[model samples]
Target: MPMLTDTIKEKLSSIQGLVFTEINNYPCIEVPKEKILEVAKKLRDECEIDQIRDVVGVDRFTKNDRFECIYNLYSHPLKIRIFLRVKLDSKNPEVESLCPVWSGANWMEREVYDMFGIIFLSHTDLRRIYMMDEYQYYPLRKDYPLMGLPGAVQLPKK
Candidate 1:
């Protein structure tokens, strides 16, 4: 059996500045900020990725200016999948949502935007999907500081 990672790396090595990563032990390709949409197109057509499984964002609060948009794609016929992760700086953690190519992405992208507070430029019908209107922070963001009920137990202090 051919190594999936090597095959993909060799095929995409020409996509300058592209990096490959492993997500949840699966093959993941990371494209440069400027090349996201282009790469997505290539992956869909030339690479035969027919399905957009999910679109979500990851918050790396430990690092300054750290955010990422992740796309999981697969092809039923080929039984192969690839993960595309696009890194964006916190100053402008925005990306062009590939809703045009994959209509299913419409809801997924909006949900990600709602949770990460990262704007997806050109994403049709971009709005708060899960949260109520005027909600301030992105709940899934690591920096959001998820906490339990306030003062669940009292502590004696001197």
Candidate 2:
């Protein structure tokens, strides 16, 4: 698998706005937010990545771009998995939706948005899936209180 990883790294390195890194020995690619849709199209059309296993959002408040949207993709025929990441500015964490590339990403992107407040551009329905519509804050951020906020304890109005 290392050979395949190296080959993929070599192939993707030439793509503009792509930066490669390794996590737990697995190759991960970082792409500019504006180029994510183009990159996803390439990964799906050319690399046989058929499944988007997961979409995760991370908030590292100390970093320059405090938010990251991560995608885990799998190719069953190739028997390989790949990670793609896009760093987003803390002030406006928004990126183009991948649901166009992978239909399964619709709900996954909503979940990330609900938890991390990251907006998905061009998503058919970008709304809170887990939390109520009136919920005001993203719960997964590091700054959120452990127990609950003052207003969070109030029961929803009937």
Candidate 3:
């Protein structure tokens, strides 16, 4: 994949509170949670990022701001991809929804919410994608029990 052009780098750098860096040769931006929406908008409008490949959640189980959200974006025209990483508080993992900028982010965001318990604010239909609506536990968190929570959800008998 091609790296971000100097012009693109300049544009991205203009966004306040964004740290531009590269991971495995692909451009990655560390964005503050409060500036996520603004950065997403700039990427779409000014950078021509047309697709959001995926939204991934990470659980760094230690202390202080343990949750993170990584948004994988692709610019079809530029043939380049970039990652937007945002850290969230472990106590309340919530961030603005990118669905407003990329409609395709809907299900991706929901999946992150479903598995990681990270809430996407203003998401059109933020609900459990795999688990039942009443399900309380997030199965993918590092702290989740290996065997699963007892009586959290009853299985159907054959």
Candidate 4:
């Protein structure tokens, strides 16, 4: 099978509201948060991207946007990988949920929400998957305390 080529990249870039770019040598496309669901549906149906491999969040504390959410997708038949990124502001970071596109995204989106405090708008059951319901801080943030915060649960006494 042929690998993802320039022609394919150009086709993706040609999508009305998407930008093809790269990050750390990996080909990436930035999709406006509002358009993520639409673009994701197209990629799944047209490109045969069968799986959402992972969803990750980066905390760029110093940057004005402050966070980036990345979606890693794989096309099983074509043997290709694509990365979709969405930049979000630090305060009240939120993006449309992908659960409607791929059911597997339910847990992945919840994980991102748990660690990064980003809301998946319209998610049927958005909640903390790992952290406690009352935990106040996003532990993965660059500004979170290294020693853990006061009043939150501490390590169990040995």
Estimate every model's Cα lDDT from 0 to 1: 0.79, 0.89, 0.89, 0.84
On lDDT, the candidate that comes out on top is 3
Q: Candidates ranked by lDDT, best first? A: 3, 2, 4, 1
lDDT tens digits, residue span 7-37, model 3: 6778777677878778798888899999999
lDDT of 2 by residue, 45-141 (tens): 8777899999999999865899998899998989888899999998888999999999999999999999999999999999999998988989999
Q: How does candidate 1 score on lDDT?
A: 0.79
Question: Could you say which candidate leads in TM-score?
Answer: 3
Whole-model lDDT, candidate 3? 0.89
Question: What are the runs in model 3 whose C-alpha is more than 4 Å off?
Answer: 1-5, 155-158
What global local distance difference test value does model 4 have? 0.84
Span of 10 residues, lowest total lDDT, candidate 3: 1-10
**Model 3 TM-score (2 dp):** 0.93
Residue 86, model 3: lDDT of 97
RMSD of 1: 6.4
Q: What would the TM-score be for candidate 1 when compared with the true structure?
A: 0.82
Please give, for residues 1-158, the per-residue lDDT of candidate 4 as tens digits. 22464645545664677787776666788888888888888788877888999999888996578988999988899877879999998777999998988889999999998998989999999999999897878899988888988878755778
Off by over 4 Å in 1: 1-13, 147-158
lDDT of 1 by residue, 1-158 (tens): 13866766666666898877777777888787788888877777766678999986888875665888889888776788788988888887888888877788999999998988888889869989997656666789876657833553355698
